[model samples]
Target: MTQSMNHEETFENPIIPGFYPDPSICRVGEDYYLVTSTFHYFPGVPIFHSKDLVNWRQIGHVLDRPSQLNLDGTPSSRGIYAPTIRYHQGVFYMITTFVESKKGARRNFYVTAENPAGPWSDPNWLEDAPGIDPSLFFDDDGRVYMTANRVPPSGREYPKHMEIWLQELDIEKKQLIGPKYSLWDGALKQIHAQEAPHLYKIEGQYYLMIAEGGTGFTHSVTIARSESITGPYENCKMNPILTHRHLGRDYPITSVGHADIVQTQNGEWWIVCLATRPYGGEYRNLGRESFLVPFRWENGWPVVNPGKGIVEMTTKRPHLKSFPWPTRPACDHFDTPQLDMAWNFIRTPRDHFWSLTERPGHLRLRLKPERMTEICNPSFVGRRQQHMTFAARTMMVFDPQNEWETAGLVLLQDHDFQYRMESALHESKNIIRLIKREHGEEEVIATQEIAGQRLYLKVEAAGQDYHFYYARHAEEWQVLAEYMDGRLLSTDVAGGFVGAYIGLFASSQGHDSLNVADFDWFEYIGVPQQ
Candidate 1:
């Protein structure tokens, strides 16, 4: 992976702002490696590294290597699901599930690498595991076990019939060895649904940590433990170890769950998981991305979100030792072969569609099929949404003479609900404007003519709303759309496990030739108090 040289100030809250989700973290000898679900974003499973959890840097992607993953025709919301990162004997492993487009085709897969930042091995299919969110546990006795969701034999419907299951695995053969046993059921006695199982053993106790509550604003974190690997596990006396309960219907951090736990150098326990915050109770452009939470053990059970049982916007860093003293670069000038760890695709991405040039320091994105549904095309690329409130800005230059070119920055979430500001040919003249995907139409919300081919566009999402802006001349910036209701762009309203993501985009909806977009720099600023 190519590293950036541009020096930029890194903010604290959104450590990695964009659209990353389903974070699984592991600490190896003073260094931390964080991986998250790609969900159709080819070059799947973004891997981020940090010396200090607060200062994260995109080292590389585990799925970049073909042997690691593949998604030729994967849907916008189907490819990679929740992934769990585990390290055993210096080899790093990630277990996950792939939901095929056809019915009854969901399957579990695994990948391994000697190094966290590496050329990972190809995925190995584990059959008979018919569910999502597969996790691995390598015990001290040199035994490997798998825990995942399985459809109940009685009912065929999902979300209502899924149950957590456990089975021992033969790592050498890449197959299950023993009979599967039922561990727990999500719909047994709760309104919240179950998924994302991460198994581990702490101090002789086998722990099973899972996420429930539908991964929505009502999402929550839950845990269960057993004396043995397959016996009846007991739910935490106080379930929902962590959550943001104070925010009514529209606070920032909504749909937070799907977690993986790790132990720091000081034996401190911490979790890296997914969560989202609407900008003014309206938009979740960054989709459910990654988050960090502290874990404490009380009276033999795990306790998180312990303080008044509410997640906080600003909390103290996890109690872990910090090394790698100085942090890596944050601001990107787009001068590398590989995009930053902060970058991802909504669906599988075609390598030929995007590039980062070193000579002029710009991101060149080739236009893909216009009006392509988010599910199938490999054109989308994005990053994890890591903040409740922030400002994302990018500068781009388009082919002014080309009416076929439409390039802009987007605050994207699934297929519906997204705000876009692009450069297009308007009345034979190049105009920069803000357009939104509302009620399934690309309605023009704001527009302004430009003198040259260069323009800077930005989206600011804070509290529970969003604002769009643009600058033809670098020094003077103009607001296009202000504090628009974001819920119009939400999954609850738009439908998807994702939130909004702000990034560069290009498309040739119905053009004769390919449109090109060149991005100069992308910056994100955490929202400040009024």
Candidate 2:
């Protein structure tokens, strides 16, 4: 997809930032569409559109229906893995793996839509496909193939010893036809887990690319090519076409790999991949973010970030003309008919638990039996905390009818690590409390009895510190908890593939309270870096 560039604007790296990772792009005429992994969040695989590669707007999610994605008991970072989006003929196809099957194994599925902003068809499960990071390639002669990583057919020499495989796909029937062929293992001899494979047929030569050395500090992108669609593929002389693993942990950007390549209308080539931004030491709380890098062909091989061989914070925008899209509102007033695309639920939500229309201009969340610390779905709706330094506030009116009922604002990393400033019944008194849960241990840090039912809860983040505040009114904010270590909510500390999410939550703490919390508004404003 190509976009109409009508203006000139300098775009930065991470064109699509904050918890959005493993991005795959496809160009259909003048429009470019991209998809990213959403893990256990419902309405999975966010779809983005751009005229130029730099500026992107989320059009919609590829899996908007519960039937299309089932993450009921799935833990954080266990639902959808890497996804690939490709436009073939008049259809847009997305292929991904669901890692939480009841059968205790990974399952692959594909969905299609006529338009990228979709009512995507229900999943066509690949019953025989046996791996993650599945990608589809449509050749020049109407031939189609699917590629993925799997255990070697011969046997398993060691854990994570895998190979890239290719199989012909029957487009009309949506099934695999020919025998699966083993393509390439990986580039580095010591590296295992060769995954995230993409195929490109350029200038009559078939090129195969894969990510190796896992997805952590050792992450790197490697390339190989063959004259035939299936190899005897030769590894590139300069393997590891792109990576920042060797740059040390202090480089700010690390864990770079799982990339997809695209050529613009003007013939400029680029890649979108996942990388981390370590803040306050080598802890990456933001998780893997999407980054853009430029590339060129040298001696029939692709060379990424040519001069430096590392992703930059700022680079020249793609050759395509620039057309900027409107940004999402910083505050949600609950004034819209439907929730914004930026908001996401922890899992498949109970249809009647939360409503924007029940009370005009307010989001009413009824207390449920589950707590935020449970693995099951909870009454929680949140958006990614995109900025390291930012302020998030919510006005909640909740008079808990029972001691078990609570409603408040939360910075959630997962079930085990999170902080909540909540309004609940404490000793038959209406009080606001600051609670912290680290590694499954819950602690009540501070509590104050409030005179009114309506109160404002805020959390201010600066670098590695988070301060929780509460106020009887919006203007008089008093600190409840000061300089709480925010790194405790980071991915490095939490042990997950997700970033921190600032959201509103309501729960009965495992008891049925039949209580409700109404949120007047939710605001998240970024504090500029000084």
Maximum-lDDT candidate:
2
Q: Top TM-score: which candidate number? A: 2
lDDT of 1 at 399: 78
lDDT (CA) per prediction? 0.71, 0.88
In model 1, how large is the Cα lDDT of residue 476? 79
Instruction: Give one digit per residue, the lDDT tens place, for model 2 in 138-202.
Output: 99988999999998888767677889999999978988988999998655557788999999999
lDDT of 2 at 233: 96
> Which pairs, if any, clash in model 2?
1-27, 1-28, 1-31, 1-32, 2-30, 2-31, 3-30, 3-51, 5-321
Model 1 off-target regions past 4 Å?
A: 1-18, 51-53, 102-104, 156-159, 186-188, 243-256, 305-310, 316-319, 324-331, 357-359, 372-389, 400-402, 461-465, 478-483, 528-530
Backbone clash numbers for all candidates listed: 38, 9
